[model samples]
Target chain A: MISQLFFLLLTSVAIYVFAKNLAKIRRNILLGKDIQLNDNKAKRWQTMIKVAFGQSKMAVRPVPFILHLIVYVGFVLINIEVLEILIDGLFGTHRVLSFLGPVYHMAIGFFEILAFGVLVACILFLARRYILKIARFQSPELSGKPNKDAATILLVEIILMAALLTMNAADQLLQSRGAEHYINAGAFPISSWLAAPLFVSFNNDTLVLIERASWWFHIIGIFAFMNYLPFSKHFHIIMAFPNTFYSNLKAKGELNNMASVTQEVKLMLDPTTSTPEGYAPPTSFGVKDVQDLTWKNLLDAYTCTECGRCTSSCPQNITGKLLSPRKIVMDVRDRLEEVGKNIDANNGSFADDGKNLHSYISEEELWACNTCNACVEACPININPMEIIVEMRRYKVMEQSSAPTSLNNMFNNLENNQAPWQFSPMDRANWTLEG
Target chain B: MSDFRVKTMAEVAASGEEAEILFWVGCAGSFDERAQKITKAIAKILHHAGIKFAILGTEEACTGDPAKRAGNEFLFQMMAMQNITTLNMYGIKKIVTGCPHCFNTLKNEYPELGGNYEVLHHTTLINQLLQTGKLSIRGGAFKGQRITYHDSCYLGRANDIYEAPREIIEKLDAALVEMKRSRTNGLCCGAGGAQMFKDAENGKKEVNLERADDMLETQPKVVAAACPFCMTMLRDGVKHHNKEHEIEVKDLAELVANAMEL
Candidate 1:
């Protein structure tokens, strides 16, 4: 009864904290403008399955691809065991799914193998990030807390897998001894073979204590990790599915035109319609703040894994330019969090603190993009960082009127001559001669 | 040279005739001397194929690709509205252009501005003609010559058109070689996104020079491109490397035109 009461209290606290953070994140994402993405349900489903579930784009690099596949498969399959763990924790039962007999043995046996795979993958990942010091991991944007956050997630995963194996080992030993309250449950072929020697000398009572300690540690660690996701780049684990589903389905180069501006242009061009009475031009043109972007853009920010694949493939970054696509996504996410916190502090309404995305993302970084879509193509989860960069640039040019001198000249020429060049419209046909 | 009569939309309208397509002579094709050669070569191919085509002539304005890319939305909308009105007045349907920037903007973006047309890149049209036997290439000059095709970013990745230009090159009976970064993985030619209008930002190496190095690594006798912006950037990069005299940079239409001896 005491164990069940403790379990209920711990589970309640964990659920409350996790749900609160998730709700906050949802609200922050909802702060952006609405974008209708309901069309083409079939295509969106296909994209989510292929890109996020199948990990199709991640296969471009063979080494990381295989390692990521192992971790991904292991994480997904191991969660089935987590479901059993949850049942056992709630009811103070011992391997509740063991009632399925042989099928239960096979399921536990499969999860044990995957748990081993997860352990090995986490170690390899740690070595790749810290020991091997891959260039992408060492990018300037990931130097501080981002780098530590990644390492912490990996380290915590390693601990969780270790605790799982340890718990299984002790449970197996206790089961062999026919200890009370610890029945002959769970088939641990891998852990038994590996962990038998470590626990052979220990007695049944001590084995029960070891099993209980590891069980508690693993569950608490998982709960803590679940809550940590809202603050970490590992949030992609949950967001990648929705982000891939809502991805832009048009041609990669197609820019999203502002509907209000498009309507204004149409009115100006229409020969039959004149301006409405008391017409007022828009106060702002492009995305100057988080509110100016679409919900999809904000979701993209929260979904970024900060893997630096986008930055690694960016032409501007390759050529030593200021733009790093990963940083662009990260900055948007940071700004969104800042804005979310501000709203929380001000009685459910945000008071302007005079800070925007531009405070972190500089003008040089915005102008350095080639709009080549390389970053979009390289993103394993279909994150379009270039879209954010272009939106910010639209703000700079349209709202601020601070485009580069050459661009200003080009705009002037385009307004006066109907082309980017400074030449008469009649001269457009001067290159041609009669046959 | 063939006596190819290029008619303007105005001429066709006055004559009470309709054309099958409109040749959108993009800004580069109209003003840039080298790109003008590509425009003429495309016209030659269209004439040989007996395709009824008319140009917008002086009524043709920019597609607002550069302006839109450079974040000048007001200017882009203004230019797009004017061009859409002109094209609508002519009741134009199918259009083709040799510039990838113009092709991308016209095909993908113009519809949002209320201008919709069946837009095709020149290489796509040429490949279509070859497939239907509307055009034939003898390959008399380019036969067995080693040629490498550069994928323009706007044409290849943005528009997903990797095979059309390659298909055109293969029709020449030439050995088509690929750079290390070709097709969807192709790099930019450094002149996209209105980069052609200004100097490059500070960087260790110019993007075109790096891409030009990729083409040179293939060691082809001819470097072929389908976009005018790519032609200018690759030509400049080739000139920078002093390989202009050794490796000839030609458009796909030029190769097809030469193969047909037009």
Candidate 2:
């Protein structure tokens, strides 16, 4: 009872905190005007029908697709199992799942088989991510990565599941239980085999105590997963769906027009860019850094699973360009978290006067982009890499007045003759005459 | 300049003028001697069809494509407004031009600036005149010469026009061999997007060269194009690579003119 109470209390607090933080993040994104770009009416129903429920992106890569599907389906259906374990652990009630009809018993039995399939799939995933180091599956470059956190957490999840199955199978087989208690009789093969031997040593009382411990451990494991989620890289599991749903759906190069300069002055100037000459007017331009980036960009950063799928498909990256769209998202996210920590601690104090702003990204990385929409289109999770890159470019061009030297001559020619070429306006007709 | 009166499509078509088509002798047609030959041949073909038309002469300005694509939206807006005023003053309606870039800007981009008019590529107009039995080819077919058509990006992808040019090529006794990347997926001649005004990005070979190489693979005697800009670029590309002697570059109108024994 004490264990059950403790587990409930901890899980409720974790859920509450996570929900509050997610809401705050969403509110911040709305405040940044990220939601205005999406014209959701035309394709909202279609996108919801296709992307949200259809799982199309997963199908793009088949290896991870099958394994992830099994695991995800197992994860969802295991909630009922979790409830059964929680109820039994708290009240000493056996057969908590037997309240359902015979069909429900069969359904639970099928999911038990699926849970075992998930364990096997998890093993394969571990091999693919670690030993083989499948390029797409690996994480982005990290400084001082603990390395053990992922491996340890994954191994713990698998083993805890294995132990719980073993404990359930042992209780069903050796406790002299009747057939009516057979909620998962034809499922969990290896656990059933291990059950017969365990019954030979432990009596009924001992078996009951062992079963109760397994039930308690499984419930506790679930609560622990909830508590550890926000701090873990696995937080994408909770956030990715919503991020993908609200992803940018617009023409490739059509940038959302910035609000007018006069409108900003009327709204009381933000202190971030306040100047000595009264108020530093908000320039209607692109993004320069984390602060300039929209909340959707920040969400994109956090939701990235470090899949490197974008990098693999990028034409510029493949051709030896310094840009990697995936890295841009990761870097933005890492910097945001770092700066967020500073802001939280110092009551919104400046970090080294924003000198560390470009620590994660470089000017070379910014200029190398060809503004190709391939990265964004290839991203199965629906992150708009082009929007962020273009926003940064807008900042570079407008605020810094720093662009390629070639563009200088081009801009000058355009200013003089209304064309990028240095030819006289009279020469525009030369080609037609030559024809 | 005033004496070189530019007549509008409405004036020529509605008034039953001597010319059957109003040839929008684009800026290049009037100034460049080589392109002038194409416009003249087209004029002679229309004369043979007994169709009445007039050239706009120096009244036509640059179509504002270069300004629009180069991020100079304000300049584009200004140029478009100027052209609209000129076009409206002339009472023009139907336009036939040999330049795809001009055709695209007039057809697609001009409407954004509130300039709407019926614009047709010369190849389509010529093909239609021939199909309607209004024009007859004289007894001459250059049967042995193999030819390939280069799909201009503006006419192909930007405007989704591929059939009219192909129909014209088929009607002529020329073999229309396609480049490796053709039609909607056709590459730029490194001339569109206002690139003709500036040198290409460093270290990247000109897009026209890549296209020219594809043309060479076809081993056609003549490489043909519809857009004046594409003709200029492909001709330069063929010459730059020393393949000018191996293959000739001609506009589609020029080829049809030759086929008609004009």
Candidate 3:
């Protein structure tokens, strides 16, 4: 009964902390400007199912695809076992779902096999990131905390899977000895084969103690992992669904028009319409800070897994340009977090820090993008870093009037001649008659 | 070079007649020396197919694709509005262009500014002409010749047009070899997003040069491109490698015109 009380207390604290962090992230994402995404509900749901739940995009690279699939399936199936653990812990029952009989055995057997797969996959992933030193994983953007965070998540997963298998192994040994109060439960086809030797020499009492310790460690490790998600790129495990659902469904080359700018241009072009009295134009044209971006853009930043697929496929990055699309998304998320903390410290309003996205993301990086859509196509989660890059470029040109010299010349030619070249519009058809 | 007279939209309107389609002679088609051959080839194809087409002539302004891509939205709007007004005045319902940038802007971007028309890229139109029996190819000029097509970024990845150019190439009776990166996974020619106007930023290598390497890997006699920008960049890259004598860069329309022996 005392142990049940302790389990309840621990579970409650974990839930409270996780809910608090989730609320904080929600508030941070909401700080951006409003944009409607209510169109095409059916398509959005289909995209969520196919891209996020189905893991369709990850299939491009087959090796990582299969490994990631194993870990993904294991993560989802193990949560079913977590439900049973919660019930058993809270009610002081041994194998609470043993009443399900044969179905319970199938469930336990499946969970053990998946646990083994997750363990093997996580170890291989760690080697790929650390020992093999894949170029994408070792990019400049992932040097410090990002690299450590990735490694830490893999370590946690390995530990959790190990504890689960160890617990099942100990339980199987106890069941075989016909130990009292330890009901003969679960079909440990995998763990019984792989981990049974580790606990075979232990007596009944010691086996019970080992099983209880493994259970506590597994449950505690999960709680720690749950809290760690919001702080890591592993946040994609939750955010990928909504991100894929809200992905831009238009042609990949389409650029979104600024509503305020479009309205102003329409009014200017309409002969029947005139400027109304006291009508003022918008001061800024595009995104200058996190607040200037739409909610979807902010959500994209939060959803980035920092896998560098986009960067690896980027023409600019491959050609050794300064632009890494992964870094652009990371900068946005880091800046948003900073602004969120500032607002919290200053009574729900942000004080000017004289810092913005440009402080972290440079002009060189923004200008290097060819708007090729390679980054958007390569992202496993469908995160569009080009959207952020273009928005920042809009801010650079319209808000600051700070385009490069050649672009300024081109802009001038466009204004004067209606073409990017410095030639009169009258000569547009001259080539038809010329050699 | 072909003995065909091009009519202007003004002449058609003054005669109380309308053309079946407007040939949108984009800036490159008008000003660039290399792109003019593509324009003439397209005009020849239309004439041979018995399709009545008219050019906007001097009344047409730029589609402002470069301006919009280079972050000059105001300039882009001004140019787009002028062109839209002119097109709406003439009641032009169908348009065709050889440039993907102009095609993309007219078909996708101009509709939001009240400029709506059925826009088709030249390769797509040529494929249609062949399919509908409006135009037939002899294919003797390129009989069994090895050719490779470069997918333009604006047309392939942006607009999902992977088959039209390839279909046209197949009609040429040529062996269509594919580069390592082609179709949906094709690499950029490095001249997109208004990059044609500006010098390339510091990089390990030029984007065009990298793409040119991909094309050279196929080792075909001709590099076929549908976009004028792709043509310019690929031609320059071929020149950079001093392979201009060995491999020729031809627009899809030029190849089709050759196959038709027009």
Candidate 4:
């Protein structure tokens, strides 16, 4: 009774918090006005098929993607298993897989295999992050910080999974040794094999206690992952579906128009509207801070799994430019949390509150963009860097009257002669004479 | 404002009711003598076909392509509106243009300013004339000379009309060789988007040079082009590369015109 009460209380609180955050994200998305931007029914359905289920972008970086897909699908399937664990911990019976009859054993066998595969994949990913050290994936700034918490979380998941598998193996061994066979053992061969070494020494009472303890630890470990998700890069596991569903469906290259300058100033001066309400002007044009991003961009910031698939494929980044598309999304996320904390504390604005957007993202970063849709196209979770980058350009061109010097002469010639060229319209016909 | 230009295609075509097609002798064809010769060639072809047409002379201003592409929307809108009015006065709905840039702007961009017309680049009309047996090419003028077609950016990429020009070249009996980057991937002539008016970008060799180099690699004796701008750029690039003796440039109109000597 006590265990049931404890499980209920913890799960209910976590669900409430997760629901609240999800609702906030959804509300902000509805208010962002991006849904009405474009219409292409065929492309939208094709995109859903290709991106969401086919995992095309993830497949571009094959090794990690395969690992990730297995683990992701496993985590999804394990939901029922985890529920069974919790129910068994409270009431003492693994009733969740109870419907499958003989196939329940096959299901258990599949879970063990996937869990082991996930463990190997996670280890390789960690090594890739820390050892093989893909240049785009590394954070130059994370060197001084204590990253032990990340390792601890990974370690706990591995240990909890090991415990769960061990407890299953031991129970199967006891049944083989003339113990009560509660479930059929047609498919769980590896679990039974693993149990052979320990089964002879353990009594029935000891096996039942070990199984209950493992069940409790597994349930707690999964719940802890659930609570940590919104704060982690793994948040994409929850956010990706919604992000893909609600992604901007505009023609790939179309840019959103910046708010006219006069309207921006009016909103800033008007006290009644200055408090960061939905899509209001001076509310923000370019992303000077995290709060300035549209709710979709913010959701995008959170959903990046830091796969570096975007950074690796970015032409500007590969060509030695300062524009790391992954870093840009990650930076926005880091800034969001920082500002979110500030807002919670009633500090009102961002860390670099009055700074211009250009100061945050370098001029080189802006100029280096070839406007290749590759980065956006490569993102598995539908974060569009082009949309934000172009919006910033619009603000610079329209509001700041600033642009690249190379383009300056082009603009100047255009202003005076009504062309990018120096020749007059009369001279344009000169080509016809020789032709 | 009335003196500024006429207003609408109806008014423009009304002024020239005898012609079924108004040949918009885009700025290039009117003043450039060689282009004007090609325009005269197209006129002769139409005359042979008995297709009635009239040229819109000095009354035609620039199509505002150069201005609009350079982001001068206000200037572009003005010129576009004026051009529409002048064409409308001639009762010109069916039109032909010797210039691809002019053809594209008239067909694609002019509608934004309330001037819309069925405009065909000269290659399309010439090809149609040849197919219907109204126009015939002698093929004896440039016999045995291998020619590669240079697809202009506006006529090729902006609009996907690669076949008409090539079909005309093939019919002329000049051995038509293909450039590796022909068709939609065709390199710019360093002329479109008003780049012709500006000095070439520093640290970058002219765009035409790269295009010329690609054509030279095919070892064609002649570089055939659809657009007048491309003809000038390739001619200059060929000279600069010292491939002038080995290579020469001709607009499709001039090529078809040359073959029409029979």
**Highest-scoring model, lDDT:** 3
| Deviation of model 2 at A78, angstroms | 3.0
**Deviation from native of the Cα of residue A370 in model 1, angstroms:** 1.2
Chain B TM, every candidate = 0.98, 0.88, 0.98, 0.90
lDDT of 1 by residue, B101-148 (tens): 899999998998799999999999999999999998874688889999
| Model 1 spans with C-alpha error above 4 angstroms | A267-280
iRMSD (Å), candidate 1: 1.7
CA lDDT of A18 in candidate 2? 72
Q: What is the DockQ of candidate 1?
A: 0.64
Off by over 4 Å in 4: A20-46, A138-160, A178-186, A194-206, A257-292, A347-352, A355-359, B1-262
Superposed by TM-score, candidate 3 places the C-alpha of residue A301 at a distance from the truth, in angstroms, of 0.7
In model 3, residue pairs whose N, Cα or C atoms come closer than 3 Å (at least 3 residues apart or on different chains), thus clashing, are none
Model 1 accuracy (lDDT, Cα):
0.88
Minimum summed lDDT over a 10-residue window in model 4 chain A is located at A253-262
The candidates score, on chain A by TM-score, as follows: 0.96, 0.83, 0.97, 0.81
Candidate 3 lDDT over A1-435, as tens digits, reads 999999999999999999999999889998888877879999999989999999898998899999999999999989998999999999999899989999998999999999999999999999999999989998888989999999999999999999999999999998889998788888998888898987798899899998999999999999989999999999999999899998888888878766577668877777566666886878888778999888888899999989999998888888888899999999999999999999999999999999988899998998888888888888888899988888888889888999899999988887787678888878888876753
The candidate maximizing DockQ is 3
Please, what is the whole-model Cα lDDT of each candidate in the order they appear? 0.88, 0.64, 0.89, 0.65
